[model samples]
Target: MFISFEGIDGSGKSTQLSLLRDVLEAKGHSVITIREPGATLLSESIREILLSNKQTITSTAELLLFSSARTQLVEMIIEPALRDGKYILCDRYVDSTTAYQGYGRQLNMEHVELCNKIATRGVMPHVTFFIDVAYEQAQQRMQFTPGSAEPDRMERSGREFFERVREGYLAIAKSDPQRFVVIDGHRNREEIHADIVAYL
Candidate 1:
């Protein structure tokens, strides 16, 4: 099973993905986890540059840079891992760009979707879990990382933009009930994990 977990920053995707992988593997299932824009070192470098505050680029530049990293990750990390018959869990997927860039940046969805297809070569998750959280709470969680000095670019997106991103997730979830599973991330870890497992 190829599963994708998505939401705005601090929606508990990481915790859930990690937990799910552990549970699935314990059941004798081989599992792989792929984070967006970063997996291998090369792709991680791209992720840093893309999320850095050092560069000044337009929204289109942002979209293209992200796509480039995704293309590399898909070819280098994901494709090979999937061919080995391992189940995959992704932190985020094309739905992120479609929501953030397409709706949040007000870019064209048709254009964005086409670009995603080319970048990922049509590889997508069979089950997408969107951790639902209120915009305010997500922003609040990102405000103070324990050891962090600053927020990453995506994390630093203002509440308004993040709200749009949240809306985008909702829209995607609504669009495909069969494939997309929206969960309330505000619950405790065990509760959320139970919900995800129940879905599977």
Candidate 2:
């Protein structure tokens, strides 16, 4: 089984994914967890460049970079693991590109969808859980203290951008109800985990 978790940064998708992984493992299932633009050498390098606050990358460039990293990850790790009958739990996936680049950045949907198709080579997740959180709540969660690590380039895209991204996720979920599960992120962690586990 292939499962993907999607949400804006600080929406708790990662925590839920970790929790689900633990539960699945305890049940004797082989599972592998990975994050987008990461989990592989090439992808990790791209992740650094993509997230660097100092770098000034255009929206188009960002989309291609993310796609490139995804291609490498899918080819190197995800595909093989799934073939070995392991459950793949991904922190983020193609939907992120659609939300961030397609909606947040206002890129052409056609181009974004084409890039997504090429990147994954049609390998989509069996299920995608979108943890929905309000923009204000997400911002509050993302706030950093003095001397702490600063927000990444993407994280600093401001309110309007993330609002559009959130809308994009909701739209995507609406379009694919069978594969996409929208989970309210305002609830307690245990409640959210219960819903996810119950779905599985």
- Top candidate (lDDT): 2
Candidate 2 global CA lDDT score? 0.94
Per-residue CA lDDT of model 1 for 40-159, tens digit only, reads 787788899988988776788888878888888888878888889889898988888988898888788888888899988988888999999887777666665477557877777788
Q: Which regions of candidate 2 are displaced past 4 Å?
A: 144-148
**Model 2 over residues 1-200: C-alpha lDDT tens digits?**
89999999888888899999999999999999999989999999999999998879999999999999999999999999989999999999999999999999999999999999999989999999999999888777667433537889998998899999999999999899999999999998899999999988
**Per-model lDDT:** 0.85, 0.94
Point to the candidate with the largest TM-score: 2
Give the range where candidate 1 is weakest over 10 consecutive residues by summed lDDT.
140-149
Using all chains and alpha carbons, the TM-scores for the candidates as numbered come to: 0.94, 0.97
